[model samples]
Target: MTRFNALLLALLAVAVPLSLLAGRVWIDPFDPQLPNAAVIFIELRLPRAVLALVLGAGLGTAGAAMQGYLRNPLADPGLFGIAPGAALGAVLSFWTGWAASGWALPLFALIGAGGAMALLGLIAGRGGGVLLFTLAGMMIASLAGALMSLAISLSPTPFAMSEIVTWLMGALADRGWAEVWIAAPLTALGLAVLGLAGRSLDALSLGDLAARSLGVDPRRLQALMIAGIGLTVGASVAVAGIIGFVGLMVPHFVRPHTDGRPSALIVPSALAGALLLLVADCLCRVLPLQGELRLGIALSLLGAPFFLALLLRLKRELA
Candidate 1:
């Protein structure tokens, strides 16, 4: 398993740069204006590929952390309310014309995600148990989702509706280095926090009581994990506007190579996530559909059944 993980990581490292180059070369195929392609490469495809890699790594690592902390294999940042909350924030910002220019949407999204985490923290009722906390996560997500739906329903302008729907579905089409610059630092910080807490996550797998018995402070670790996941997913949702299932799916795919161990989960998951998103984005470009395929739609088509299988497996384990 370790060997497999190592090989996977190496392949991903090589593939990311190659994928960027491949995407650039493929963008305007059969064009006689090959000499002017440098501007296109520098201005468009390069940034898009970088965004995919960053978003994928952030989602993958955060998903691993969420699952570890909650002791639930099916956990995702969106399931815990962050994505919907962020979406509401972004869409509302756009709807109100408050952040009509630049990256104001993503900034508001981060604020919305933070607000959701804060609300959940308060709802957990001053150090609530795991089940109570998890329920709070669900409640907040549901509430945010409802609000987002209402906003969309009430939107009168076609342009606004189009923008809202496009972002919600998640696409890397027009993003550039500016978006990359905004997301990169936040992702790096989130990864650092996750790395620091890896041992704690490993302890958590043995159950709360056992973890405490072994000198692990489960509650504190859980708090840190939530903060980490919130920040990471918030940043991602800010930029990508809710690319789902990468979080849930990438970790599951990588778990085998890590032997189901949390301590070894982060890096492998990050690599697999980069691989998944790159391939997904590539497929989006090549699909025969009239409109561009959205990342969220692609992930849903690929991940929904996998999520169901995971649920069945969990039920079996519980039984």
Candidate 2:
């Protein structure tokens, strides 16, 4: 499993750079237009690939942390309503024209995600347990999605409505180094926090009573872990809108290599998440289509089927 993870990481190292060269505008090094090509490479292509890597890893590691803490296979930042809350914030900012204030889009999105986390915790209540928390997440996510739909339905103009729709669908198009810088640091910090909590998560798998018997403070661990996820996944949602399934799928993909150790899944899932998104982003560039496929749409097309398969597998296992 360790060897497999190492190989995957090595492949990702090569894949990310290759993705920069995958766009529709072909760059010839020997051509007289090389300088223009270099400009495009530096400005657009590089940022897009870097974003897929950073944001993807953020979602992945955040999901792993959430799943480990909850001891649930269905746990994910998106599923838990964090990303949708962020999306609602960004969409509201755009719709109401409040994002004109400097950095309001990302700021509002972060606040929204944090708000959703708080709301979820509140609904879960004291000692509510994982089942109650998961149910609360579903309710919160549904409410957030409904509110977004309401905003779209009440949009003042067709153009505004279109913008809302496009933003919800998500894209990495035309993003620049500024977006990369904004997301990268927040994600890195969150990942570091989650990494430090890895041992705590391992203890958690033994159940709360056993973990406490071992001197592990389960509540403190849960709070810090949730905070880490909010920071990391919120940054991703702020930048990328609502790219789902990376969080949900990456941990499952790496589960085998982790030997079922949820803690061990963290780094590998993060790496795999980045790799998957880069590959998907590369396909968005090279695939023949009427218009470039949105990253969110492309991911949904891929992820939805995997989700169904996962459900079926669970059913069979229970059977």
Evaluate residue 203 in candidate 1 and report its C-alpha lDDT on the 0 to 100 scale: 80
Q: What is the lDDT of residue 106 in candidate 1?
A: 86
Q: Evaluated with lDDT, which candidate comes out highest?
A: 2
Candidate 1 off by > 4 Å? 23-33, 312-319
lDDT (C-alpha) at residue 250 in model 1: 84
**Each candidate's lDDT (Cα)?**
0.81, 0.83
State the lDDT of candidate 1 residue by residue for 53-157, as single tens digits. 888888999888888878888888677787788888998987887657887898899899889888877887555367888888899989998998898888868
| Candidate 2 local Cα displacement, residue 42, angstroms | 0.4
Q: Count the backbone clashes (under 3 Å) in each candidate.
A: 0, 0
Instruction: Give TM-scores for every candidate, taking all chains together and pairing residue i with residue i.
Output: 0.91, 0.93
